[model samples]
Target: MSAIYDRVALIGLGLIAGSMAHAIREGGLAREVVGYARSAETRETAREINLCDRIVDSAAEAVADADLVVLAVPVGAMAAVAADIAPHLKPGATVTDVGSVKQSVIDAVAPHIPQGIHFVPGHPLAGTEHSGPRAGFASLFRNRWWLLTPLPDTDPAAVDRLTDLVRAMGAKTDRMEPAHHDLVLAVTSHAPHLIAFTMVGVADHLRRVTDEEVVQYSAAGFRDFTRIAASDPTMWRDVFLHNKDATLDILGRFTEELFVLQRAIRMGDGQQLFDYFTRTRAIRRGII
Candidate 1:
């Protein structure tokens, strides 16, 4: 595909940013991909890997003259990054993000956007447990859903341009309402990550299960839990904190369901346990 944007700046050099750089290059989505990270070490690593056409020292420098800027930092860090880059952004530049939660990120970022710039908050529902520059690959977004939550006054032409680049990188694009996006993610991603973390923590606290035994015997459910629990801690912390209301709401419902299951097991209700598993199994199959 032809370059959708003359230049695109990625404001953070983590997995998502790294992956975007690769995809943009592979798909020819942009003529230039300039990357910047808060850490000198990360910038150096990205340079070493040749992750972007240009690895600039400052977020401002990375975004200078770029047609599109991507905020790829944690949700908690969005406000500061937005404030830092607001002054340097090119007029008419379309700004987007790869944050998991939408409403909080938009709230943190939108006000800093200048009059001429378009803020299109987005989330790519794709990742692995691993992080950092080296963890990214070009195909990471292939067939993945990339969601955009644009504000009412956002420029439609800018949104379409960004959508074209995203689709060129092999992702399917869809638009969502910011608050509703947060609730949906809380159900599909936030609560599940919390549960996996909790389950792994419980296993660690179980004195009877030695570390070696846990690791060796973890070829089953516990193994999958560890994979989820092993995700970037900082990112997950920010997600949970920023998406507080929705995450808490989902967790509350999960607790109610857990209580019902616990009662059934305690009362030896074999039929209830079987029925519950059967229903959940169908959901899993449907996803497959």
Candidate 2:
């Protein structure tokens, strides 16, 4: 165990922030963790949970003298958080974020970062449907992918420092351009979450009409969608609102493919349906 940073400031006290606190404490990655949240209730809860060495009232107050600052807020709040912490961050301190969408986060936070500080936009491809400080577990990052989208002029030493911190938290690290990261995640995570939310909504409506029969006999497939759809509404809402373009692009492609399958089913085109099933099955096995 090694202390990578003398002090680490966390800008939000949600699941991701709590997990980071736990991970850093368990691994001795930071000498101290200072945290801030918008709601007084959340800050109080974070203190009760003992997630940080210190909990403060404002973002500016938290980042003072911290060697590394992690903005674990929603993607939509990146710029505002960056603005709040900019003046307080010590020179040469590293700043990063745990946002789902990378491009928008980079766009929002990059301009607000001061010249002497390092801004390394990152996304940990991990989390459960749960939200709030209570939902976090120390092992959430184990075996997860932590993606870093560093700017071209980013200092190599700072990049390596963040990468080491990520690995210390039990996540393996990867790198990509911010735009590519957003596009890939739009198809993999964002689109699936949207589809799950829609399906759950549709099922609930159908259940209302049919008197709850759908829930009574739900199979594994629909049940899984329900679990995913049960995710925190505020987080998902922020994700969709901030990553609109990529999400809509993927949704358009999904709709087009869905229409083709619908036509095959309507026409009783057995061979086309069989081929589609086989192809999808192969893809599924490939994932394994």
Candidate 3:
């Protein structure tokens, strides 16, 4: 791996950004990596851990003369961060984001980008339930998918450069239309997370089940639900709010499937239950 950018600025020193810092350093993908976070404590932690070559006090300072600027903040904060850094961006610099909800983030940040800069929206399909500056590792993105939803008018050279950098950092890159990406993510990520949160909440609400028993007896299935539910609430809330329509569409389909399963259980339709499970099991096998 060699240097792809002279300088890369990362805004928000959380899990994704921190992991990127580690990966960039490990791969030598950027000559200089600088970062910023809104929280003073987060900045202190980043400094303590040497998360980046330089940790700046402001987003503006972090992005000064940067060749690549990555907005790694929450989806809801994209616009504000974009506005703050827009005026400071170098003329030929490329700006990209790690927001899960592509359309809303583009709507928020695109208007703030200056004329000569490139704005490419992206989402990396990789992470653990863990977060914060200390929770990242260089291999977090290894063999994981990094989807970019660049606008049709975006510069091909800029997109190619970004793809090179991500690939060097151990991710497989793919490009898609923004709206289609949102819908795909809704089925693959968002709705599943919502179901996990709901299942965990149901366990909490069940009076007949003691909390101790639920904790002690949680099988692998329920434990996986808890892991998904443990994702950052602020990030998940913004994701759901921004991606409402796609998520709702997927959730509606999921509800219909759930109702069918419920009816099968109630009516003792063993054939229907077995066939449904068999088909779904095949899908899991495909994923594996």
For lDDT, the strongest prediction is: 3
Model 2 residue 232 lDDT score: 83
Taken over the whole model, the C-alpha lDDT of each candidate is 0.93, 0.91, 0.95
Residues forming the 10-long window of minimal summed lDDT in candidate 3: 127-136
- Name every residue pair that clashes in candidate 2: none
- CA lDDT, candidate 1, residue 80: 97
TM-score of each: 0.97, 0.97, 0.98
lDDT of 1 by residue, 49-113 (tens): 99999999999899999999999998899999999999999998999999999998988899899
Model 1's number of clashes is: 0
RMSD values for the candidates in order, in angstroms, are 1.1, 1.3, 1.0
Best by TM-score: 3
* Worst 10 contiguous positions by lDDT, candidate 1: 215-224
**Model 1: residues >4 Å from true position, as ranges?**
none
